[model samples]
Target: MKIQNKRLFASILFVLISVLCVAQGPPYPGGGPPGPPGFPIDGGILMGVGVALFYGVKKILGNK
Candidate 1:
């Protein structure tokens, strides 16, 4: 029971940190200043990586 509680706490902390980091990062940098509408390719690549990681974790945990 104690181990389960610790795991849950750690998961929550990890998620909170991930959310904070994402939120602190810049979004659509092009809108912030005079730019060429930001780097769409980079954004797409980042999104792809995020999706891959999400599914990879799910698969590894046998959650899917």
Candidate 2:
């Protein structure tokens, strides 16, 4: 029980940190995405980071 709680807490913390880091980080080095002028470079990069983190967390949880 304690271990499970710890794992849950750690996972939540990891996600929060990942989000904050991505949100506060610099914009993408290159110009914005191609189609329809997608989101701004910074927004695009942050979204990409968020998606990556989401998948990463999913993989980690699924594996265990």
Candidate 3:
């Protein structure tokens, strides 16, 4: 019971800290994503899809 209580306290503390940090984020400008002009809008999305596909193919082929 003591171990469970400690874990619960840690989880609550972590969530409170995360919320506080998010509330203190930098200011947004121009009512758009946080970046300068002409940012690669789909860069992160494309990279994520590419990585997922790569891993899927590797798993299908049993590379390990």
Candidate 4:
């Protein structure tokens, strides 16, 4: 096929695909689907950061 023919075919195919994509209907009345529950880190993240900072400080202040 010629280059113009190929481009026309591609444009038609793209339009059809976009129509399907945009036809997903309206959103759920109840504010869409629910996401995963929140993860409880408590003090684990802070503890890790604290330990890393302590190690870094110790290394920086150490004598050669």
Candidate 5:
């Protein structure tokens, strides 16, 4: 068979397989979906600010 025909057949098979995969809806923990995930920038934000401040001070002082 030609390469083009092979590629076309592959594409069709892939699409059909993907459709079968999602045929059943997703399962929920309870009766409905859960709430949004939490934002985890609690201590990381302070660390990032400290690093930026240290870098800025070093640049201002012309440190090597």
Candidate 6:
């Protein structure tokens, strides 16, 4: 019974918090400024990091 009550309280709190967060809005009254238009470079950076990590681990293991 205690655990059930705790879970119910947590659920209600979560819902209230989420609703309040969504209730707030940006201070701007009109449409925001236009953002940069171009392809994202994050993907390339992620791929490079992945390759580096893979090679580093492989080199550490001394597996050819």
Runs in model 1 lying further than 4 Å from the true structure: 27-64
lDDT of each: 0.84, 0.85, 0.86, 0.89, 0.89, 0.88
lDDT tens per residue, model 2, 1-64: 6999999999999999999997874455565544565546678898999999999999999998
For each of the candidates, the C-alpha root-mean-square deviation to the true structure, in angstroms, is 11.1, 14.7, 5.1, 8.8, 7.4, 5.5
Model 5: colliding residue pairs: none
Give the Cα error of residue 59 in candidate 4, in Å: 32
Let me know the TM-score candidate 4 reaches against the reference structure.
Answer: 0.42
Off by over 4 Å in 5: 29-32, 40-64
Which residue runs of candidate 4 sit more than 4 Å off their true CA positions?
Answer: 26-64
Candidate 3 lDDT by residue in tens digits, 2-57: 99999999999999999999887466665446657776668899999999999999
Per-residue accuracy of model 1 over 1-64 as CA lDDT, tens digit each: 6999999999999999999997774565754645586556768888999999999998999964
Give a tens-digit lDDT track for model 6, residues 1-64.
6999999999999999999997988656674655678867788899999999999999989965
| lDDT at residue 32 of model 6 (Cα atoms) | 66
lDDT of 4 by residue, 1-64 (tens): 9999999999999999999988887576775776658887779899999999999999989954
- Clash count of each predicted structure: 0, 0, 0, 0, 0, 0
What TM-score fits each model?
Answer: 0.39, 0.39, 0.41, 0.42, 0.41, 0.50
Global lDDT for candidate 5? 0.89
- Which 10 successive residues of model 3 have the least lDDT summed? 25-34
Q: Give the clashing pairs for model 4.
A: none
TM-score, candidate 5, is 0.41
